[model samples]
Target: MESEAAIFAGAVFSLFGGGLLVWTATCVHNHRPVAHGVRPVPSATLAGVVAVLALAIGTWCFGRL
Candidate 1:
């Protein structure tokens, strides 16, 4: 597997990003919904930022292949 490190990093980044995005979605949903009960850790905006960064890094890693 050429660029194995890249592949691994890409996979990790993509998964991390995907997870963050899911968490953010949940956070947003919970925040709004019918009414606000409690806020989750890491605001949606912050999680979104990290998620985008991770996804971008993953894309870059995959591009190396």
Candidate 2:
């Protein structure tokens, strides 16, 4: 149904937004000052963790539909 599709789309967008928020926060928290300027680089481990968490959340959301 259209409602179900809308809910699913909302869930996906929310999950993506949450992931981006976390990633941005991590980057800000781990920002490093370089010779040129401050560079915000999220660590690989942090990125991986975020990715896994996002995947889990997405799976759970879709499973509920």
Candidate 3:
């Protein structure tokens, strides 16, 4: 049972970390273009990516807990 818990905890941490990193990188990507005199990212793309990542992390954490 403890091992199971550890595995679950590790999975949750991985999911959360992965999601956060992806989201942060995407946000940076979306912003960087404008800073360099290019068009800003499409709002829909950013929102969708963020939403998917958040959902994935939430589901993973819930399963672990």
Candidate 4:
């Protein structure tokens, strides 16, 4: 069985990534080239990349379970 921490991390990361993805979509739909308020520097491309990485890490964690 996976530890409690792994489960927690997986859930958190997955949710965060999903949220990021949604935010990105909203920005794109609005015709904005950049997303703001998530990080120190706002960027559309970076946001998308980070979202994917986060989701990937979350999936990896879940796979461990």
Poorest 10 consecutive residues by lDDT, candidate 2: 32-41
Note each model's CA RMSD in angstroms.
4.5, 7.5, 6.2, 3.7
Native-referenced Cα lDDT, model 1: 0.80
Worst 10 residues of 1 by lDDT: 33-42
The TM-score obtained by model 4 is: 0.80
**Window of ten residues with lowest summed lDDT in model 3:** 31-40
Tell me which of candidates 2 and 4 scores higher on TM-score.
4
Model 4 segments more than 4 A misplaced: 36-42
lDDT of 4 by residue, 1-65 (tens): 45677889999999999999898888778876553455423577788889999999999988887
1-65 per-residue lDDT for model 1 (tens digits)? 77999999999999999988887787677664322343444455666888999999999999999
lDDT for each residue of candidate 3 in 2-29, tens digit (9 for 90 to 100): 6577567657656665665566567666
lDDT ranking of the models = 4, 1, 2, 3
Evaluate model 3: give its lDDT: 0.58
Highest TM-score: give the candidate number.
Answer: 4
lDDT of each: 0.80, 0.59, 0.58, 0.82
Candidate 2: Cα lDDT at 32: 32
Top candidate when judged by lDDT against the true structure: 4
lDDT of 2 by residue, 3-63 (tens): 5875686578567857765665665566632113433343444554566676666666666
Looking at model 2, the pairs that clash are: none
